[model samples]
Target: MNQSTNPSEASLHAIDYWQVVKNRYGVILLTFLLVFMTALVITYVMPKKYESTAVVQVRQKGTGIQVIPGMADASRYQESSSAMFFPTEFAVIKAQKTLDAAIENLDLVNRWNTDLETVRRTLKGIVDAQDIRGTSLIEIKVRYNDPKDAQKIAKEVAEAYRERRKKLQGDYSNQALDELRKAVIAQEDAVEDKRKLLSQIIRTEGIIYWGDPSVSGGPRGFTKADDAESAAKAYVDLEQEKIQLESQIETLLRYDGPQLMNYASGLSLPDNIIPVLLPQYQEQKRQYEAMKSQGRGERHPMMLSQASNLQSMEKDLVEAVANLRETLKAKLSLAQEQLARLKTRMDVKEDDAVKQGIANQNFVDAKNDFETAQRLLEQLKVKEISETMQTKITEDPIILHEEPMISNVPVSPNVTLNLALGAVVGMIFGIGVAFFLEYLDTSVKSLEDVERYLQVPVLAVIPKDVGVLYKQSGMSPDAEAYRILRTNIEFNRKNPEDNAITVVSGGAGEGKSTTLVNLAYICAQGGYTTLMIDADLRRPRLHTFFDINNSVGLTNYLTTELMLEDVILQTPVDNLYFMPSGILPADAAGILNSRRMSELIQDVKQRFDLVLVDSPPILGVSDASVLASEVDLTMIVVQHRKLPRNMLMRVKQAVENVGGHVIGVVLNNVDVRSDSQYQYYTSYYTYYAPAESQPMPSPVSSQPSQSPQPRAASKKTTSADDSKQDLY
Candidate 1:
């Protein structure tokens, strides 16, 4: 037999996983059932809980207060400060002091079946506050075993928070009011002092006010009279200058009429005519006008036309005006010079007066602005002093109906779930048990199992209850299975010359002898002339089946002086013979090992077409091994559920040790009906009719029927001659 190879990692993993599934299926099922039951129990037994909640709105405080520099806007400061204070509120609610107070107020210790410490712990578990999204609101939730208790606790906590808020806000408001009052008073005093200083400065400066003395009034300035006086004086002076210039120009034109006419005549001349004749004169005149506008002399022009024109015009006008004023020559010169001097003096005086008036007006306006600012400051101070701080809760933390106190219905323990889990577990367990039994079983139940485990061909499978072969001397279902064994042997024998086979078993009572007898019968039926030897001297059973005398069988022939023919007996079956065990031998192994036994087997093998030696179980004694070493082929018989696989291997080893080759394994005493795999092979023989059912003829005197020789005293004989008639 070939050695089994180790399975690959994947194959081993699969096998191991399958084994675990098989072995632990029951445990898994039980665990599932327990888990389901526990869930169900817990669902039925656990307490239900209810929840309650309150909504509290937080509002900024001291928003109305107005403070000095370095103090932020009251509303902004309060909002920012609230963040720092909120955690304090949360800590306060969680504190033992607050919890104890709540307990005392509600008398929760007695009402809730708890001491102060336990009540505190329960309160800690139940109460929580969280800020509302996008708003200054907090949601307070409480959970309790009782619905009413949950609601009551939530409402009470809300009420406590409201009271605390009101107290805090009231205290803050009082403090702010005191500080505001003192600030207002001090500001009022400062405003009064500033007002007095402003009034004194106005009085010392002698400024007059025209408009209302309030900041909202239109522009007011000190002394409008002085500005009006100076503006009127300047208007008078400009009017005088205009009249003087007009009169002087008119006088010049009238008095110097002839000379002016001569100058105008000279100017009237066409530039084309005058350019060559009076070029210098025109140039002097043009230069004189241009230079006069630019405050320069008339001789500046390159042609000198302006200077020459001005000199000629001046001489002519002077002469004409001198003639007109010959009688008052000195008066004319004096009058013109006096007019020029007066004009200069008037321009200087007007400029000085305008400058002085602007300065005075500007001073008065500055004084008025300063006075208005002082007045507004006084008004603000008065208002601040009169005003009082007012604080109010913008949005009160209201108990919008307390949380709904409804208990939950736990649905964990489900009977259906448990049953389902249990079924799955049970199936797993059943498969595990099946595989475990398969692993532990060592007996050969099928040809495949035998071939796979032992790496040997199964010669045959002998159906169970083969004892029927002894009762009905010929073929039976049990006998048919062995005939199949014989056929397989005949076909599988490597050498046609090797016809002597030994039948051995791993243990006793595995149907080895029956197999040998039946196989011999089958061989004989096939016209092979078969002989069966009961070589098990230790416990001979062949004589009993053949109804032959064991007194002078194989052991007697092999060990003593008995002839081999004396031990060979013919059975009722035609062409089938048996050699019984002879009387039990003390040294069965020793006798079987002798040279005579070998000679006997050799002799029989030569006489019969097939010789089957029925030896003792190989595992039981050395008899089978001895026979195996002498025979051409050794066949091992293993009963279903008889010996373990290792023990059978030991049997094979024993045979091999004796130089015997085990041709095949014969799985014996198999229950074909129970094990349906073998039913096909065992079923046909069950319904088959024996060959004896055919017609038989009476025996006639074929050789003058010789007188029957006295039958051997210890041997029983049954006739196979069908034509013989018995006469007793």
Candidate 2:
């Protein structure tokens, strides 16, 4: 017996659940019928309802007037915005105000003979508005007892919602138009102010406009003065020339001869002669150098001629340089006088350009402002006209996609669906209850449950309703369980001397006496000299099984000076004997706790190969505990799924407390057909049963013959034993 739980073993399988269902099928069937009948009754009694629906497409539309252009086209174009938009429309369709309007239009209060508040509430309850998924269409559904009423309510709701939306649009348009008119008036005044400013600039400055200022760059012409940049350019040119001429004149006066001529050659003044003469002087000097290179003296005729020509050219160059200096001086004086006069003209022209520029800027600013204001004013007028035309020819944004129609069929009391739901719910609830009761049931359910709690081996699982075996006509399949119990006891007992075993139970009606009788018969059939002793002093039932006289059994032997042969009786089954509980004792536990009882058990253990003693329920009285202490071993008989696990454990503890060795447990009265876990253990019941073709074994005598006795009680047992045996 392992105290630890094996997870795989502890978990239930599908077969286990099926077994539970089979065992409790009556309870499950009853619950299912109850639920199904309830559903049937409800469906039969429910009121019928008719449904009508109206479908309309709701769209995002603009107000008739747009204060700012293009605002209408920008509304509700995004996918996310459309998602949010439809819910709002649905709410509007189902709004209380809309419902009230529908109610008033249909005259529901007077027609239904209800108050105004009740009519409103009924209309709201009957009407349902929702948007069809992935579309802008809204469905207004109405349900009522009358098909005509349902249809009328749906149609009226749709019309009311449409009219409400249109009214809201109209109100918004009127407000926008008023704001637009104010904007247009303010724009017109702005344009007039700009126009007055422009005219004042034109009259004061005498500037003429060439073309439209808005179309062109700006005001282009200034009639009062020309551009001053021209005068400034001429003054700048002449002043630069004056500075150059003075620089050349200073260079000509500071130098003399060839240096003066070279300086004059570098200066490019107007009509200077030094450029013409310097080349002739340079040619003469080159010839003089050639003659010297020819080895001719300065006084030689050719050299003298070249030298004389160089001197003449040099004197001419100097003369030209001097003349160029005087000419530069003359130009300097002329440029200075012209620069002074032009500076005066440039100042006057700059003053005129400045005045003209100021006037032109004023004109351009005023003209731009005026043109902008005029364009805005014109747009406002166009918008106003467009808005007025739109208001006159207004179209409804809500379009009726489908008209409401009267439905002939009723929508409520769906029999098929209700029956299906009832069946499913009933099945689920029944299974839940089955498992719940199983959880609360702490009885021993399996062989493992007994071994786990009692820490003892399960000797055998006795199939439910096993009767006294020796009296059966032929071999009963149930006899195999006692055979198993016999084999287990033989193997479990360590010493041959420890042969006297008493069978006990936690509570009465647990088949303790039956198990003892069957085990003795099986052992006797297996060729062991087996003895059954009914030691239950409080309730003597073993003598009833054999129809033997209980008046001369154990209590008689323990109380009087009687030999063992006087009480022991041989049953019709060979090698099997019975010791009946002779008489009821006033003090059962006291009678069984004597030294004589211990000696009797030891004496019988030697006489019989196996001795089995039956006792009352150990937890009920002290007689079983007394017997358990006197016997060599105590075997507990536990009815399947009857005694609680803790109570079974207490039975084992009771035996141990009295210094008795517990051989094992016999799990009796199991419903093997329903409990699938034990099917394999007892499947041989049919497999090993004798075939029908075979003749039945000769019937064992149902009555037991008493051993030779001196008392007259044996004669009284003869008549009682003659009757048919009771199958316990």
Best by TM-score: 2
Report the backbone clash tally of model 1: 17
- Per-model TM-score versus the true fold: 0.45, 0.82
> For model 2, how big is the CA root-mean-square deviation?
6.5
The per-residue C-alpha lDDT of model 1 at residue 15 equals: 57
- Please estimate how well model 2 matches the true structure, expressed as its whole-model Cα lDDT: 0.80
Per-residue lDDT tens digits of candidate 1, residues 398-436? Answer: 334444344353223445665566566556555655566
Candidate 1 weakest lDDT stretch, 10 residues: 704-713
Each candidate: what lDDT? 0.64, 0.80
Residue 420 of model 1 has an lDDT of: 69
